[model samples]
Target: MVSLICTLQDHRDDVNWCAFSPTLLATCSADKTVRIYNTQDFSEVPYSPLSGHGYGVHCCCFSACGQYLASCSTDGSTVVWSTDTGEIEAVLEHPGRNPVRVCAFSPDSSHLVSGASDGTLGLWDFRTKTLHRTGAVNDTTMVACSFTPCGQMFVTGSTYGDLRLWDLDMNQLHAEKNTHDLGVTCCCFGPKILSGSGTVQFRLASCGQDSTLKIWTVSRSNTGSCKMQLLHTLTGQSAPVLSCAFSADGQLLVSGSVDKTVTVYDASQGTLLYTLNQHERYVTACAFSPSTPLFATGSMDKTVNIWRVEDGHSGHVETATFSCEGRKLLCHSRLLVSDWSEEDVGAWLCEEGLQALVENFKANNIDGAELISLTKETLASELNIESVGLRSKVLRKVEELKAGCVCTGVPDEYLCPITRELMKDPVIAADGYSYEREAIESWIATKNRSSPMTNLPLQTTLLTPNRTLKMAIGRWRTSQ
Candidate 1:
């Protein structure tokens, strides 16, 4: 059931978007600035709002790692912010009158993808801070874009009521279909809702000017490949369904509408659960906490309401205030949102690289393409990804991308302090930092008994391989 936690006047103008990070909540507005609030330390008011765009900011997003914040504007530029210091790291601008509608970081925090009113999409490299790809493949003004949990598949909706799915790795269109009868305003991939046997079953929930919320059944094969099919079409909102989000466990779906209402549904059975009517104006956006039962909604009335999403049986428990208990809150753009599938690996690719590897490894499996099916961990550990040194192989590609480039220094996060080279085997050391396994091992054996980067006494000589970093390194290497 739905229960109000608290309401905050998050913006001076219509709050276009609001997302939670582990420690903060960031909101964007037509006022042309972004404000961030501390989740745990509410004693201090928010610092000065961030502003640099020529026009009102339309959307904002905090990278998965929570190290950076990105905001897009009607002026056609996106600014990346260093969250800790509230400093701008990069200002990304594209030529044309196409106002950016939304922006989001790939789950791995390796790429930033943005959609525009001109039906254009741009993919920017976060590590190198460069715009590497742009496309005008859609003819209608695009309304929203979402990357599936793996980042291999991308979904986009347009004003003309159509949806297009693309294979990011192949850089090829996967499917195009009409689900909404009018402008497709927003869409999000459902969380992994599983069956009794522990099998994954997910759905795509979309909202539109048509006043209908469409639920789609996403079917997949043994190989991590999948397809979407119409499952259930929910119609009850008195006006346009402005935005929607799935609970982290995929047990619930929450939607906001121009009717000034919020609806909750049993995601598995597609049954109405609860309806919240606390807003004075149109509800424009909604989001759920990454690992809690908390739900939040943003509206044109200039307030953000946080709610507790309980099971249908609980009815509603009134909550006058909300507490983080150390839970990081996150919110995002018009449609760009949290990862749809698996948990975010601290070091990772986007699904684009996962897609490429799946397709390439299909022939080698005894189970054929089905064996390449993507599971929760992405690829199962049983697969022979290590047969040929995966670390060294991908690291070499990274150096190749730097050949004759004009960027300044290499992104420090991706380099190994010991060797000052792109890391092939990244591992976490005792000091809660990452380093190239070989390089750090050598440091401990021959160099001083201190952390090379911080010069602190070594806590331990042990190093654990970081699988996430391996995948991310692979993606950047291949994309370049």
Candidate 2:
């Protein structure tokens, strides 16, 4: 369900990090630069090529409000810049060649927290433009940092297999069990959940050098101590998992790995859905666009790959095998008119006309969203379909699909066994099961002489109308 959108090649060196605002994207690179690009155009901002960092920028993050951008680098400093003007507003200098490994903006955009390799941690206030606190997380190298949605607390992780939370200047251990056996590389907060009784819970996802991703459910206790419970541990990457990003809705998660692949999973079930392997080198970062079904991945290959997630309920059929190469189409879609007879097409478009309409829009290079917002007349006109009869049939089919169904409360036994939908024209098949005429015909065409539900051998291919079932269905329809 992943389709390539476009490829961005602007960084002269390895792109180490990427972040997304509501409508813009900012990337940091080993080229000693940070560039912000409009999501609309995917072009660098006019004043971008921001090159204040004396060394490679290792990480970049956007404030919750999308008004500011923050970056950390091996130059031993962190800079906060205005996203609109591309101006550096604050500079906090440290004392090392070691990269400031991790940084994140507070939920309120009022503060930024950063950590350096040697356990050096600092919290800076945006208003004062000064480092308000400097400390260390024990004696371990901090690799990951994130703030909760409410901005009341922030979390930090170490290369030493530990996770800690900061609350009003007090650091508290949130997980009794270590997240991974090795160093934690990245951690991001998942979507928030509010229970029926008003209890709040947040999901935290982390990946590490152990080559595993772990999800932890966390909550605040009455005494204000964060309580943690292990939810699930996902393991598939052959190499260390480098980064993970959660969709804004918290239903999906994408993790990058040193195995040179990006794995997408259902966040709630930990079910692996897709594995993207376009990057030649290790995938360094992953970011989900907040306002669209889009995500961008950056790697050591220095190219940013954009992808779109498809949301159709995929049928167990090979739809198409065409790529954007040589303008060739070798498709096998069941719904295409070229592949199906006119009667079959009519039958299919009758039951599932909405989906077929979308498929037509796709094939005709029409905007599918227009089908939703445009009136039937306007849509039909916009399609500019060559065959007037075909256009009328399609538009009439759409109206029938949209018109409210009058029939309801039909007996399940009178329904089509093959389609699981209420029968329009019931028929008796050789297998002796009642089904919609079109449904059983389709089943026989696809499955030969076998029963759809039982797979039993069929004695004949002929079908007869079920007069009894038809009468009952007719009465039900009339009553409704």
TM-score of every model versus the real structure? 0.62, 0.64
Q: How accurate locally, in lDDT, is each candidate?
A: 0.66, 0.71
- Residues 190-304, candidate 2: write the lDDT tens digits: 8575443334578889999999988888787655656777788888688999889899899889999999998888889988887777787899899898888878888877677
What would you estimate as the lDDT of candidate 2?
0.71
Residue 10, model 2, lDDT: 55
* Top-scoring candidate (lDDT): 2
**Where is model 2 more than 4 Å wrong at Cα?**
95-98, 173-177, 193-199, 313-480
Model 1, total clashes: 21
412: Cα error in model 1, Å? 48
lDDT of 1 by residue, 74-137 (tens): 6668899988888889988754535678887777888888887666788888899887777765
- Minimum summed lDDT over a 10-residue window in model 1 is located at 343-352
> Best by TM-score, which number?
2
